[model samples]
Target: MHPQPESGTGTTAGLPATADGRTSSAPPSGPAPAGAPDDGRMTWYVYLAIVISTFGGLIFGYDTGVAGGAAGFVADDYGLSSFMEGVVVSTSLFGGMVGAMAGGPLGDRYGRRPVLLLSGLLFTAGALISAFAPGLAVLLAARVVLGAGVGAASVLVPVYIAELAPARIRGALVSGYQLLTTLGIVLAYGVNALFGAGQAWRWSLGLAAVPGLLLAGGVLLVPESPRWLVSRGRLEAARDLLRRVRGRHDVEAELHEIRAVHRQEARAGSGGWRELNASWVRPMVLVGVLVAFFANGCGINLVIYFAPQILQSAGMGSSSSLLATVGLGAVNVVFTVVGMALVDRVGRKPLLLAGAVGMTVTLGALAVVVSVPGLPGANWLSFACLSLYIVMYAVSPGLVAYVVISEIFPLHVRAKATGVATFVIFATNLVIGLTSLPMLDRLGTATTFCLFTAVCVLFVLFCLRMPETKGRTLEELEARFRAAADSRAHARVSRGV
Candidate 1:
């Protein structure tokens, strides 16, 4: 009973029903009609949906980066020490781990939309609580809540985007999640620099509620994942929804493909942690978790969670330091877009190798520059190396790690394994975010960067053992992993201790 439009884009005028009880305005005939063109063109509505959904990534960036500028102010206001500084910074991540574990089940059991709505609610509540908190305890508690929301958002957003998009554009649309992530960071840096002098830390923390509200409101207009609908046996509804998001022919074709995969998964019966414990599952999980671990562990968060502080330690004032942090956000955004363009052109593994080598070199140079001063413009060296590190990160692990997490596992154990992997990622982020200040104070920049450089070298060796995933479908990737697992299992049985 919705109102008709004067512009002629109405549901009755050929818009097809979708899985989530909504409809797309595209023809019901689906994407192709047989031997038609398969150029993988997308409608404007697809782009619009991506924009709204990736707001989840925006919140992630804002929450993580805002603290760098506000941490000193909050610490001074609440009389906190370095340990407390780390705790406050990392509290949200702890909540994120909790949320991630919860999100996977919720997303699978219910749908992406409901879990996303819950995440929005958590974000709103956390922002309000943190803004009004009177003590370190309250602030930390509030951050935990916020982190929970962030974690849920992180998992759901990309899953949602990937599910809805066509394969040809899937990487690009998912890459939008990373792009929006950079936008959030840039926005946070600007806001922090603008209000660094005032009681603006309150504003910084509280303003996060704005995006949460927007996401809640925006999601109302999105269609459910057509694949999730098929999994639930809502074929008619799925087909109708597909008609709107995709063309008539594309809808029918995609429905067949999704149904085939779902049927295969159902027959295989492998969607839980127990299934993951089977012989073929262990190594992939190990690789996924370690990739996530080292990606976060090797100084990425140390730089991100403590950028402003690092600049201050290198001798800039708090205000100037906050301003300088914006540069990091800029570099991240620029290089991420570049990296996204290069993903298909250059492939994933090569990018990681390049990023690792670049990270090691830049980090080593940074350590040397910090230690050996008085050689004319040595201070510029610190900022330059930091910028290079940011660029290296944007192009490699920072970009690929999440994509790998999403693609690596088989469908049966995808949610649980990813949840566990994401938990490890959050846990590592918490450790780095919390202990970084004490580490910085005790270790100094020279030693810290040197340690990080060594870590990067280890990452390069680890990545060498990882397989390439360029241009691989989810089903193809799963098949290869299953074969590898079965082979390993056969070996284990033969050894029989």
Candidate 2:
């Protein structure tokens, strides 16, 4: 019989099976099949690593969505003003800026595992502090700490999965992070509904600490990223890891390719923000920033952070609104899974286009419904449109943006460029969190959603310019962009002539 693996977790506790179909917990002692072909089935090792890493996304989803539900109770207890509410909501994004910037260097210098470990510790520290926070200031500080964890996790986890995975299933594997993020959001909503009514937002906030702790501990079981090892010139270590993960027949060949890529990158000069100003770099950066803006802009943050408040304004009780938000989270998770399943098959750009179209339709209908006064079941109609909006986003940009960040930039500059992109995302989110309520109060629901609808239109246009990066290797992608930049420079010189 095949060796029995450990219980609960899918991986075996002893040595993993050899490529020759033999099993052992002992390290490889022979020339392994490092370059051998795979069976093409999702390996147990790969899937488990993804499952564990996605917990980082869970923390992100929970922290972001939980605030919207819990903040209302916080406001009631402390009698917060619009400014104070915005401050409270925007704290995480502010910290996320630091985390996003920090993530790249940390991942590059320390490898994916250590940085992930740091993220988990930050998450635990942030969550515990927030749970017992006695004042608005304390809570905001705690949220900042937590945001750092989210920002780092957001960048690193997908990169980890992307680097470890083969091209055939990379899209789906990376998308696991997005799907889990949705689950985290949905679970947050459920937790809020279960605990928010009795002034139990503290419990809701504290609960996130559990997953953070688990992530911190669970990361030890996963392997260090081979690409990260290759970058550091640790060829022997990288080879060992690849052999174990991919099995023996493919190790030497994979290492040869990885080393060649690293040498090429080294010769290309170290990548920097200056590259982003180059012609091809300019368009890709624009694509990342605008996609991020629409992803968080367009009032999605407003809806998430203030959904319960909006429901209460529409005439539901606070508790009832919290429960309704839970329903919305459920829908969000389901559609996100659908999006994950489709990403590899459908490609990134098409899903984004579909999501943009869906956002346009749903948000437009929402504006109309919220505008009508006491028109039979207007509140329900508005709620339905809101749910629809989430459904569209969950399957499209919600998942796609993360994939783009994972695969778009060259490997050499990937960490830094993605950090910049993430900073833009959180910065835009901060603006949304700070101003969304005032926008809603001053502009009314109709005008507010109309603004989002306009953003959706812009998102559609911007997405059309995004390259289809599916099924492409990181080396191929980098070469394409570099060549494109070179061609543009030649054109400019010709024009000057």
Candidate 3:
């Protein structure tokens, strides 16, 4: 049913496919051959798309991080109880969960670009409402509105980059979303420190509007995802966009590869939720969901949203705690750069395994340091441990999780599948955000961190089961996963499970 490509064309020779759909050989790197036109590396338009779309990430980071410091002032301003504080802080994540669930179907139906543009508008409106909200209820409503944009951007931005980037630099390019997220968080921390003492949480919460407006306006200038265009049977449009992004490369071969895979899926009736019931589809979706869930379950958001509170508990003053949070933000941004640099060369799995081990050790150490009473330099020790934890997280799971989730699914269901995975992420985030303050108040800091440490240990085991996706084309990765999924299904039938 699928159209065949011309012989000796389409896919390159070195990256061979196995009986299972995975690529058997490593993808080629660096410049193209001597006779080739350009290296097919990044072009101006590609850079533009990446920069513009990732502003959504900036909004994601700012809105999420601003709440950390803003929550204290908000509590003061509204006389919020601990329970109410948690409610206010977590309402956005609930909205994010809703947005993520909707993003996939909407993005798949319309396109990645329109969904992104809509996210920017939602983000802008939410920020303004949050900044100007007169009461706790209004603030909560505004947070939910803002959160929807964050959730949609979370699913759509990485998918956009992954779909657009050339295979050679795809890992690095996709990681840009995470990198910008950290940068936005760092910006929020700086803003929080500047305003923490002045009853200026309104400024901190509302500053997100600037980036939201920028993103909303900027996305209009970029092209839509070539893959999305092809999926809609807009062959010429897909070709033109691919040429713009990829430049002098052989567009026909790439187009054929995309079309061939899409055609195969079409014949197999593989779209929407019903197709997910197929045995092969289930594993990929499961892996994506687990990866998204565990990324949050490891208690990253606990530190992210409650770093100031965590420091305050460790005997630091409000000013000192806000300053310490800035340090944590700095560490996050710096090590995220480390992740961006190494992801393409060192691969995704190793980084994840390393980060998990490092987080377990750091969180356990932080718990012990904080739990001991009257210990010398305990506050500073906690800061050090927290910084190290941020480094470990930023360098590994923080970045790789987004990249892997974006890369693992087949193209046809990618938007829907990513939406599902992102929903799991936000759901986990909502639970953590809501429970973090209460957990600290009721269970104590040491016990709370020990719980997170345990989750990191579980994550290490999860990483062992994940496939490596670096240095491969989207088409190759899709085939490999399908093959592996089929093989597992056959084995399951053999066992009568």
Query: Against the true structure, whose lDDT is highest?
Result: 3
Q: How many residue pairs clash in each candidate?
A: 23, 15, 3
For candidate 3, list the clashing residue pairs, or say none.
Answer: 21-479, 21-480, 22-480
Candidate order by lDDT, decreasing, is: 3, 2, 1
lDDT of 3: 0.86
Residue 489 lDDT (model 1): 71
Cα deviation at 118, candidate 3, in Å, is 0.2
Worst 10 residues of 1 by lDDT: 1-10
lDDT per residue for candidate 1 within 1-497, as digits (tens), equals: 11111232233223455454454322345343343222355766667777888888888888888877777789888888988877778889999999888888787778778888888889888988999988778888998998898888787777777677665556667778788888888888898888887857989999889887877777887888776676665666777777777755455555655555665666666465576676566777887898788788879888887887777666667776777789889999999998888776677778888898899999899888878756556656678889999999998887777777777776556667777787888988988887788878999888988888999999999888888766666666777887886777788889993
* Runs with alpha carbons beyond 4 Å of true place in candidate 1: 1-39, 373-375, 486-497
Model 3, 1-497: lDDT tens digits are 22222223334333444555443322233433344222447889999999999998899888778887788788887898887888888888998998999999899989999999999999899999999998888989989988999899999999999999887788888989998999999999999999877879999988999999989999999999998887886666777787788876466667667767787788677487777666677788888998898888999999999998888888888788888888899899999999999999999999988999999999999999999998888888999999999999999989999999998888888998999999999899889988999899999999999999999999999998888998888888888877987888799999999
Off by over 4 Å in 2: 1-41, 272-275, 278-282, 493-497
TM-scores for the candidates: 0.88, 0.89, 0.91
TM-score of 1: 0.88
